[model samples]
Target chain A: MKHLSKVALLVAGVALAACSQPHLDGSGTGTGSGLGEAGSASDPTSVAYFNETIGDRVLFEVDQSTLSEQGRLVVLAQANWLLANSDFTAVIEGHADEQGTREYNLALGARRAAAVQELLVSQGVASNRLKTVSYGKERPLEVCSQEACYAQNRRSVTVLTAGLSS
Target chain B: MKKLAASLLIGLCAFGAMAQLAKAQSGPLRIEITDGVIEPLPYAVPDLVAETPGSNQIAKDMARVIAADLNGTGLFREIPAKAHISTITHFGSPVQFADWKAINAQALITGGVSVSGNELEVKFRVFDVFAGQELGNGLRFKGTTDGWRRMAHKVADAVYSRITGEGGYFDSRVVFVSETGPKNDRKKRLAIMDYDGANLQYLTDSSSIVLAPRFSPTGDRVLYTSYETGFPQVYVLNVGSAQRRVLSNQSGTMSFAPRFSPDGKSVVMSVTEGGNTDLYKMAIGGGKRVRLTSTPSIETAPSFSPDGSQIVFESDRSGSPQLYIMSANGGEAKRISFGQGRYGTPVWSPRGDLIAFTKQNKGRFHIGVMRTDGSDERLLTASFLDEGPTWAPNGRVIMFTRETRGSDGVSALYSVDVSGRNLKRVEVTGGGSDPAWSPLQ
Candidate 1:
């Protein structure tokens, strides 16, 4: 039964992604390969495009969870992308820099993820379509200890998946 | 000096001796541990006499473990066997006091090992060389050959207790999160080992992330946070059986930082709902949930006092993370930390006299301890990142996580004496973090 549902989800994802997926070979054959690929950076609906072009993450200052103006602008764009891609749901993973205690960083990460969730809900995204989890300082995008890396490490990343809200 | 002798007698009695020896001629040889720097007392432990032939390797291995346990404490230094003028050929042989005194050996440990089929038996004694008498009674342990290390630890604990007039922690175990892979995507699983980093066993796989595994008071079970269900939840695992299950399953809420109460009947942890987090206590079997704190700020890392009457935790209600104390039952809490830097992960000492915490100040993280009322706070270590301090079973030492700086930084377990001395890395394969020391087994 579990296997059947997983196959159903993959087939449904290919069908949904095929609508806006750009043809790479221009052969006019919808092979449904775009869903499994790394998702092209030029395709507006691709995961890579959402991550790079539309800005899928927002950073926070050290020891602070309140969103900055620039962070708010980034989240605003993320909200619009989520609103346009109604067939997709997102899981916002919160992270922290290596400057705080493990448990405190987890709570701090939760605050950051919630701040982004609040912004997305206010911008007409369905609240039920979003979930959040905190990784604290365990997962860091940048491993350096300087401010440049720390600023990037303390972030909330919205990861998209092709499925209905749980 | 009279009171010291009495305490030594009591410690020896509590350690379960098989036979009591007469007191030394002058006074009992003891090392009074203090905050001042101490010169490691010299001691010698020759290889245990293998009563049965072909068991020589096991006997030597056990002696090496016991020697390592004593020397690792920094309070005792082992005298090399080559420096010894006399060797212990028999467990029942009378000691040569003049020979040991000539070599400046203050303490002497002698033992014998005998194996019968799968059964192993060990007998040992501690002697004060200059005093010309045995410090305590001789003890014997019987177990399987596979449990020789534990027998060695038991001997080391008894020897340490008799010489230092304090409880021993060598027989304890530590539950920790083992890590591997890169910082961006690390693989973590629950693993446990003897206090000396031997007999390693993995409790869970790296498919799910586990953190801060704490042993129950009896050391039969462990409580930790797991992200297996895509969110943080508390899990109780049976150490012997390796069977585990989620403790709480409240939807729309995330639970983490779980600690067992002194009685092991309940657990206190942080539950996050909406955007804020608060402290909550619930029975281990899942019944009525008691809300411990209701604040707008974050409250986490709650640890019960040894007496189970009070709790010490970290909260950010005062604009920064600091330590707080409150009743075991839900009520108001008094702030206990007023230092310049932020403090978190407050753990009540097993002795109930001190609380260990992780402090971040001036761009450096530290593992520190302070009195229960927040007086005489002392930082024991400073590094790029050092946190999650767990007290030894005797509360005289602390083990914590220390991660180095840079992109290739890895987390490892390090322990320090409570007196701010004897800082050394706990040898474990690969990387480790969030070590929680179990009670003496």
Candidate 2:
């Protein structure tokens, strides 16, 4: 009980500290500060801040890896975030909606992750700092079998790694 | 994988002479079997006589295993032993054909067991009840006590061979990914076990994700995909020593779904360079990799035919996944899947007659088989999630992965006969997927 209380106090202290940090750092005044990986501690410049506030995951259509207009805009915002924070490297994780064969979905996931990486590089995010991996249909954000859940499951997530603070 | 022919010299029984005489006079009372799933032939197996102390329990368990093997095939029905009116208390006892025939048993098997130190010896015979004679010469198998399951499998193989006139798959092993933990963050390890899900031995720990373990033609080496390097890569493992190495360490490249060629010296798999995933072939002994397909679209899940003349793989070049066939040397591809569903993971049966695959259509997944040309498609199973099919050595049955739905979704291994009868869940200790049946051992 004592250890639990200590952890609770530490979490509360961190929460208060996060609430005090300034959030106006991005080149364009967006909701997120466009932080690096270290900013996941609630700093505005952390990619974690970008993910939670501006969205780092983009959903795809059923069995299709082609990015929608909204998905394109999401990737563009991610590209701009990466451009503003060039010190942060990234790995895009591609996933499927669990409606297909394991092997095909794996390939589809690869295509999706690659699509995101390509778009980022095309927008001037250093290609050398980016890598791609397909989690395939093995990982899903939603569990329900309906289309609503599937739409959520079919996604490509850009995860920033190795921040400038390090 | 060698089939032991019933050599008449192994039998010490005097009935060997009588069996040859009966084969000539009565033309061997073999039951006629058709392709259709007919009523299984009823058989009776009495508890094996324990000729030595401490052999009593093993002898009974051996008899039960043999009975379970035959009865599980949907080809034989083992009558309850309690209904028996007569018992063979001695291994050399005379036949009680009338008692077995009265119980509607078309066949009867008698076995004797003796244990000495760490070794166990078993002797068994199959009798055609109506014919009033033994079908073939009696068989004997001796091994260490720990090999009791194999002894039982050998006995079942003998009985199944005599009855069905086809090779038995009882003595085979399967390499699969044993899954654990929850659905979203599941962990998988490479594992080898008996075809009946007995004697599981894990080859790798759950530290790294593993998938789609395929056995070589000789069953001594395994080709599988592992995420140990933080990406999906193919690795070959020596089953006995567990010594493993990555098949291809190409920088910035990812490979998976490795399958050995028919000759066992080469592996055909899928490798993704940059963003395009295509099929590639590499030598098992290590050499320059040969590219098999050059499509910009994803082409993967390549499997060799039994004779190594062709390969059946899945490609999405048409914008949707479909089955395709091409020469072993790689060239123009011919699409085989014309059904209304997306097809992937085309595995050629060991018998070289059919290709088993996973299909997705109208929100349901199926494990199906088709001819080499994609004709005569038969959906063997339909479920919310069924995929990753591997064929038994004899091509008589198929085992695949079946996952449940919902937040608590879990994957388990299941098998069904080629005739779609005898659909049963393999009793694995934990969650498992991607089962690859080894050739007979």
- Please tell me which predicted candidate would have the highest DockQ against the true structure: 1
CAPRI grade, predicted model 2: incorrect
Worst 10 residues of 1 chain B by lDDT: B1-10
- Runs of candidate 2 with Cα error greater than 4 angstroms are A1-37, A40-44, A163-166, B1-33
For candidate 2, write residues B281-396 as lDDT tens digits. 98998899999999899899999999998999999899788999999989999999999978989999989999999998887788889999989998888888889899999888
Candidate 1 segments whose C-alpha is farther than 4 A from its true place: A1-48, B1-26
Positional deviation of A28 in candidate 1, in angstroms? 32
Q: Would you list the clashing residue pairs of candidate 2?
A: A35-A45, A35-A46, A36-A45, A36-A46
Candidate 2 residue-wise lDDT, A29-123, digit = tens? 11112334444637767766777766778889887778999999999998888888777787777889778877777788888888888899899
For candidate 1, the clash count comes to 0
Place model 1 in a CAPRI quality band.
incorrect
Worst 10 residues of 2 chain B by lDDT: B1-10
Instruction: For all candidates, state DockQ relative to the true structure.
Output: 0.17, 0.14
